[model samples]
Target: MAELPLADYARTLTGDIQTLAEAEDGSIPRTFTRWALEQLEESGFVSNMTVAYHSGHGVMVYGFGYSDDRSVLDLYTTAFSLDPMVDRLTKADVTRHYRRLLAFLQKAGSIRGNFDQPTEVHQLCEGVEKLLSNASKVRLFLFSNCESAARTQPEPTEFQGLPVEHHLWDLARLYRHQTSGAASEPIVVQFDPPINCLSVQSVEPNLSVTLAVVPGRHLAELYEEHRTRLLELNVRAFLQARSTVNRGIRLTLLNEPGRFLTYNNGITATATAAEFVEDAEGRRVGIRSLTGLQIVNGGQTTATLHHVFKRDKKDLDGVSVQMKLTLMGSDDLMAIVPSISRYSNTQNKVTLVDLSANDKFHVEFERVSRTLWAPPTTPGGPQTRWFYERARGSYAVEEAKQQTSIVARRKFKAENPAAQRFAKSDLAKFVNAWSGLPHLVSRGAQKSFAAFQANVKEQPPVIDADYCRRTIAMGILFKEVDKVAKAHDAGSHKALITAYTTARLCEETGRRIDLDRIWREQQVSDAIVQAAHDLCPLIMDMVIQEGKHVTEWAKSSKCWEEVSRIPWTVPEELAEELLARPVEFAVDTREEEEEQLSRLKQIELSEWEMLADWARETRALELAEQQIATTIAAKLATNATITAAQVRKALEVYDNAIEEGFSAFAP
Candidate 1:
């Protein structure tokens, strides 16, 4: 096995650092903090989270500790990178960090400006106090690029008797993680005897599930101890945004405590491993401790229960929560965790991309990407490879470990010609660019990515080898156009320029040239290259007419969308303006010229009708027509919208849709 050098490993672990020593400069602490978080999220310890730097009271990174309903961070957390910033990371430094954290927590209740607290700290003080006041346990994570040592004070379970948990992500732990990408050890919790009674049975090899009726208080305590780490990443990603669901769950608990269990579907949770306290006859009496506890579903319900108990001071004396806890080997857990999260909460319309991290399609794509290589760019040169990271951290792990046991850790990036590598989002842009809808390509990456995913699910054939080749060619063309445009000082309108130019050129070339053949040859034609170089100035002029302010016009994707709807007559109009002056790829004969004109006119006619239909339906026709005529002296045109019948066929192909359609809203 090839061992990755520290520099390569560090680069893989943290994109910003080049060498292990670089991490010593206060960078590794923050980088490792993120890496540990990724491990936590992947291991079902926490949900997908965005850390806000400089938000947590001079802390480097701060956000909600948990993913479910308890999103508010009561645990005032921070990290100190011990490099040049500090000569040594001693117990004293750790103590001061915690002291600063406690001092902030103590004054969190009142936002009074007694002393000059940073705006971030003052703003969060009141909310932190409220979350902590109702909190069963608060946790402070002190991440550092330093060795772990004895604490100045005994590492107490409680801070001033408030049940505070301390977690240290020190340099040694980080070093092991960086080298091997090992998982964070699961937090184990022992169940009290007679724990609401349960039945257990093996479901698969190394997998057993227990069915039980757990008390609301028991569930609340568990969530409090683990916070958001209890929820699976998908559930957290779905529920992290503040919503009215929290209030609704709280109201139900306070007003109709008896109906809460019935109203809520309870929780589907998992554990990496489990132990049972058995009776004399070997009957399972109670669960001793569950390692790596994670709630795959019902995050909202758990958080709501915790919120009601903590914030409202309400007693859950008679409340109970239905629990389905599955115990599986850590290896098995990785394979099916996302699937569990996907099907667990049918009530929420979770976006497919969020649910698609472990999706077979992505897996297959990664396989194809790694296996396929472009022919050597020069004779005897090594064939170039494309890396596709189906899951996060795949590249670093692969480089360091040279393995693919974890689907989520595979990388999809190539070392040379870095721009050739495509992430899922970039793949979406490439696909959209060639789907007879370059307008979608110009809309922006996020929108394009969502659209592309819908296409993938609705159209599996969209990702075959031929399609991948075309996407690579499109990337090549896009990059070249961008390079050419920048050379001519095109500025912000560069993308807009590249997009329309490609669309119209593709339209023109299709009449005489076979587009598929170009991709099949894996070669960008000289004519196309020439066209891209020649078209930059002309497209810039068109953009100026449509948008006087180059900056605003360049940034306006919405404007580009409107412009693309037009029939794009500029190519033909420019040709006509130079008709007498022999154009390089001009129609050589009368019949050929007529044929090209006929196709353009046909396209223009259809575009006018489509524009009119779209305009009549949405009143955008007038605006589209105005932009087109003003910019290129053409009518707005668009590809026909997908018909309902076609959509039905797609649904049938995928076998998806609500089997039993119900009313739009429950009465």
Candidate 2:
């Protein structure tokens, strides 16, 4: 939690990494790699394919798979020069790196190897071929922590006759993300000489709505430049949607070309700002730049355009499509952009929770937590503060304002439990850990998020005081276990420490201790803390023993994923092993929590009875019964058994009653 210079922080992080490397246990590097990849996955760089292993091809790490946008992803990560003066990455350096990797790609079919084979480069090559053959295009991403003075991009190349483009995720790019609290980089779209467009100011302040007819060539060119960055979070949904090629759109682009506008419903986009050049007569209509452009709608159309242009060598000179652009600068726009995207899509079925960064339920928790602080463990101890980041950039902004004292910033982070920094993905990881699904937990952030969203969709739990408190309590338990594990050091096996904390430590400790009661009391008991200190050492030993089966254990993402798969079942074999050993508690506390809740439910039922009776007895309720029943019936139809007649009756009288109440029943 200490606030050091940015360079110092990087040094410390990499220094710990160096120690992790020398320790040669594969825990630290594997753990750090997972954290960085998860951060990237959350930011929209990688998609469902997060698993990576060291290939020993002069590359530190490599992963090849399908990205969220349905593009072929061949990602390679390596450290860049930490020296501040090294401002630019040379083209020669990148070319040589790929050339070394090319040996594997050249013979993709010969890549059969065991899971932990040292020649994992062969598997990576096989992935590249699978993606290239099936995907519309292949993209290569190179990540580095070194700051680039300017945008240093890679030239496009070909693999097995498939189109491939290169993208650089350098340190300056990451620093910008750190300051802005953004996950993905903003894409700047320049429209030279003022294309055909119309602009109108929105009723909402600082928002402008514009409609423009963009040439197919220009659209294709933009996609070529930015690739999946333009798709935003919807990239996953876009890929998952029907793969039925838009044959009609493709044919039109290849054949008629001119009638493309009539056939296509143009894309709807959102941009942060618009730059315009005034005409000689000072007419402010010439647009020079469109910053932070994201294609919220019409993804399929744009992708189809690019695909046909490349595949069929179609002429796009006469092909143009309509585009609706929303320009807004308010931070609040981040919340609503997903809503706009959901409604604008005529093609795909979008899930509400998946569309936005975090839904209203998450934001409400942030709002509530900021108002209350958890009770300290000791009677007079300072209450542990809870900080919830509803927006990504707030933490950095808060730190910058406290520049005078590094201790003040460190105190802020210490007070704020790491678990309380719950974004949508973080919440998913927590819930999965508790749900007894170590496989889902091991699947990394995006997969965990999808699984969690699916769980919510199946049974929407009430996000009330108890739920929020318990969620925070779960976070407290996980973080506390982590602290205990780290303090023990476990021979610098931080990954094992992290893995055990989430997979076993939290689940076991949670089951044995009364978490709900602890949440209600607002503090962790020393009994649980001592239990973690006692249990972690044994768990670490088991993990280390399991890890010895593989060579280069700490070197690959696969090693961590493999370790994460170990069963964390309670009162089972592993639990029995631990219970047989000297430990603090050997009982499950959920039974006691359930007994208390059963009594509380009876009290709640009595309260509901009074409210139900009041509703039936009040004449005012009978007077508005038609409208109220209609509203209830409409909602009930979504998930409940309702007849067509009942639905029609509810709809038929509801509107007429409202109309009559306004005029016939007017006072």
Candidate 3:
């Protein structure tokens, strides 16, 4: 086994031979440099590549990167050591130039994500790879680099110690537009990596609430589980260059959970909880480890905490973790935490453990759940509490020793394990039912949206949601469908699907939600809404037009466009059911063909003309039927007595009557 370094494994698999060898030395040869330039041709990475030469052999090149709107950043210098004008410069100056250029480049989207899979550049992201000894410390490795014009003489730009410029760019853009002529603006652009953003923060005291979490992704499997979205960065020099990476926002969450205290009026926060003596024999029970104080309110209803930053919800999984929550405070005040004595409504102890103020407690639970909601309207009539933390301290940090000191413990026989008989009063069941709402809706909507996509011939069908929203004049939602569908991020695509589904569902109920004017509500971002509205109508129009052309030969020419625009006159769902049967088009049946062929033979051209003339004349009482007595035309669909043969026979009768009159004249 190679037993390569953890990060280098990726570089070894997909990296170029020349690039990999010199990646340690931080240089690229001409051949690989040329390769890098061509890889990003279709990608919106570089605008133009130009080369200049000095003193006949010395060469210099400058790359200019532009944003979509064509705003220019400073020069992106690749390797100028070959250029004669810059060749005389000291190594120190070259390094400074590269660093300065990096800073400037980051001002745009100048982060090297993955050098290996050049094709997936826009679809991926790269971060740092750190192995911090934290309960939630993470390491992300997005391997990427860029090369200039020289084909065989360059190494991709890399980071041995640098700041993540893309995030910086995003932050700056977010701020620049938000502030209109604010004094806080900085003039000469200076990018210092790890720039700290300052804001006011407050920490509230420990409050009690019941919480339950369902296990999810393992921390180490962040990218493995979300490989579809993660941009695989070059891990080649990650170990040597770890200093240049940003693991993510760092913060500590302090938690101390106490019991819910109850009084006659209602339940409230507990100030303290009493501790119990250790008993090894008889009824065994497990107690919450060292609990006197808890963080958060007892009746925490509906709360959602997304990451403060736009960190991928999945990257959070990469955080290696050891969570810690502690219970430490005055023993006297702790008695108030689980006070069944003072707050019990009935004499039979207490249904819920009561809490008193001023008790400190802690837990070693990692908060990995994406968003937690504890609603007051819990289904089981129990309140729930939940929190989302960015970073947490190590649970192995001397917290295991504190586990012995717990408050009142619940006990039951092995035959009837207390866990087996948790009541509606228990906290676990309450949270499960309440917190499942969003996911439940999303899962259902996913199925419906997929079905619609399969049926729609258009590349991206207008979200059924947009249709409803448009009906109600919500122009923004009507517009966002297309944007989300083609977004580089799959999450965004899924979210777009969900949004469209919800909008459609809402419309089906006659909610009067206008999608065309969805911008009025401002529920979604402007870009997303515009993308949907602008793209959907064109797709619909195209599908309709194409359908018109295709079905023109099959349908009557005059009605072809109408048929195409309306597509199927019958409902789509019903069409499937109808198609399942064995079909027999009446026009194609052999029996019908024979009848049409036989009828054609009876109508001769002379007879046809003679019959036509007689029918036109009103004075032709001289037995017009006598002119066409041998006809054998088909009968009417509901022929009571009218057949082509009967008409001919009647004409013969008229001729006989005329003959009889002539004979009487001769007599």
Candidate 4:
């Protein structure tokens, strides 16, 4: 079924939202869940009544709701309520509901929202992070569109950029880890090692980054058409432009590909050069050149501004720019970054980038700011520095003012150490403001037992039973069982709960393998439930990577593992990492016999697979002649006339006999 159109959700629940949100704290009950959900109709949100599972808190029952056109903004979160040892909701409860709902939503899509919740308060933000991780599960669920004979679906991607090669790097790292004491090791490995991808870069003057799609990461079904559209409509145009150049003169341009090309960031094009010389008035402003390289459409000239991404193409022609760019290449070269240039894109988003100069691809820009005192540093150096400079130039006081937003800090780090420390150190004040909780925590827990013991020793004698009892409360003793399981059968990082789920989801849904059976057969079924554990960050990754094409999340950590591995190398045949092979020898005697029999049968079956019907008929004729001789000999009560000698003589006129081709055994 199609995903619930976000529009309808709003239309149905218009005024009723306050009832859902403002219900007397925890007043909503299971009975009301269904009624509220009926209002949702096609919305993918599940209700508390729909789920019955064990959660960190206790046995959890959940009900869900979502916004559609009713959302007014044309977007709203998929709402959910949890009945974990209770009924109804609160802010914290809703947040937890959102976390879980986000997990399920991510099972098929992408999600957007700040990790607004404090990380130190609890694992809520972390859970949200895990919930939002490599969210290909929802992506896979959306693969339903691919199964449709009606419309072609988009290809899967690491987010939506980072082509297969870029993905390959991540994949390489994943497979390296998976095969090297991570996931199940494979026997064969093929790779182009030590390769770095310049898939991500921040644009100059803006600090807006361009994230390239990982090659092969996007399944052909997810956004193949978009990519194809970019290629056929955008990439093709660039290629066509380059091909049109008379002799060494080359040119290609796009007024602006809107939205898609623009994406989460506004900048759209990148340029590079063999050498960029910031020449002009003594003032060293910025790279400036002639603006408005117009395009003639139906005899009407359309003004289009281009940014130079790479400059090494064709002698790195032109001058008057303050920055001298020479030998402009991909991100690997220090001369450039992977980012989009602004204003150049007014026509379209999701535009295909024009690539030129066999070895280099960059943005095309105009000369204007020839003096800024800053020389173009490679990759994102210029833009990052410029952003800081730009901020100080425009709003020094406001920029310097104390800010509490996490998103702000993430995007723009403060130059001053005091500003940097404000988030971590000042947080205690906010934490203490709460009445019940005592002391605060950092973003990370101790990685080792000694560290944990040290933390315990420092705590006051009066411990919060709530904290220590959480272990017995949840019944999830990860540390102890892990060691026991390791002693028995030690291969699994069983800790990476999400990847296992991803592997299973891929297997079960892809019809490639059965994961449940494997789980049951393994010694540690509890260990395998790591799916939801890793869910948070993976979903976050999906949203970060995708930006908007997909937004909304659900499912557990296990699902994200698949998304995380998108860039890594998994052999099509083996379906595991294609690097660092470590093999295990297994001898199943009965299985070996069965395999040998299958091989033999296959050889016999090849008789038909390899031969034409007439050759079979010719053999039949030879059999009939031998039978006829045998019949005549029986009538005469003597030796058969068609003896082996006679049959051999008749068949060997040319002396060369036809032999069956040998069949090779398939693994």
lDDT of 1 at 497: 64
Question: What is the per-residue lDDT of model 1 for residues 426-531, given as tens digits with 9 covering 90 to 100?
Answer: 5666556555445555444333455666666554543456545555666666655656665665533445566656655554444233334444454555655666
- lDDT scores of the candidates, listed in order: 0.53, 0.57, 0.25, 0.24
Better of 2 and 3 by TM-score: 2
TM-score of 2: 0.63
Best by TM-score: 2
Off by over 4 Å in 3: 1-294, 298-492, 502-571, 574-667
Query: CA shift at 538, candidate 4, in angstroms?
Result: 2.8
Q: How many clashes does each candidate structure show, in the order listed?
A: 10, 1, 93, 158
lDDT by residue for model 4 (1-667), tens: 1121222222212222334334312223322332333222211121111211112332122322111111101001222223211222333433343344334333322212322322111222223233334312221111000011222223433323222110011112212221221111211211122111122223543222222221111111212212111111122222121112121111322222222222222112222321112237432222222111111110001101111111112222221111111112333322222122112334344222222111111010001111112222344433221111111111222232323465553343332211111111112211121111111111111011112222322332222222212211111222223233223221111222222223322332232322222222322233333322333243234423322221122222323444545443323433431123321122224433454434433423233232223234345335544343334334234432334443343333212213332222322
Which clashing pairs does model 2 show?
A: 26-554
TM-score of 4: 0.17
**What TM-score do all the candidates reach, one by one?**
0.52, 0.63, 0.17, 0.17
TM-score-wise, the better of 1 and 3 is 1
Candidates' RMSD to native = 15.9, 11.0, 32.2, 29.3
1-667 in candidate 3: lDDT tens per residue?
1122212222221243243324323234332332232222111122222111111112222232222111122133333222222133343434444455444333322232423322212111111111111112111111122112222211334433321222111111222321221111121111122112111111424432222221112211322222111111111111111111122222210111111111112112221332222246622122222222222121111000112112224333322221111222334333433452234223232222221111110111112211222223324443222221111111111122333433211111112211111111111111111122212222221222222222221222222322222222322232234234334222212222323333332222233233332323434444333433433343233322321321111112233232223322332332232223321112213333345444533444344344434433533434445343323222222223444445445445435544544222232
lDDT of residue 93 for candidate 4 = 38
Summing lDDT over every window of 10 consecutive residues in candidate 3, give the lowest-scoring window.
234-243
Q: What is the Cα-based lDDT of residue 429 in candidate 1?
A: 63
Please give, for residues 437-486, the per-residue lDDT of candidate 2 as tens digits: 54454444555566676666445555655566667676666656656766
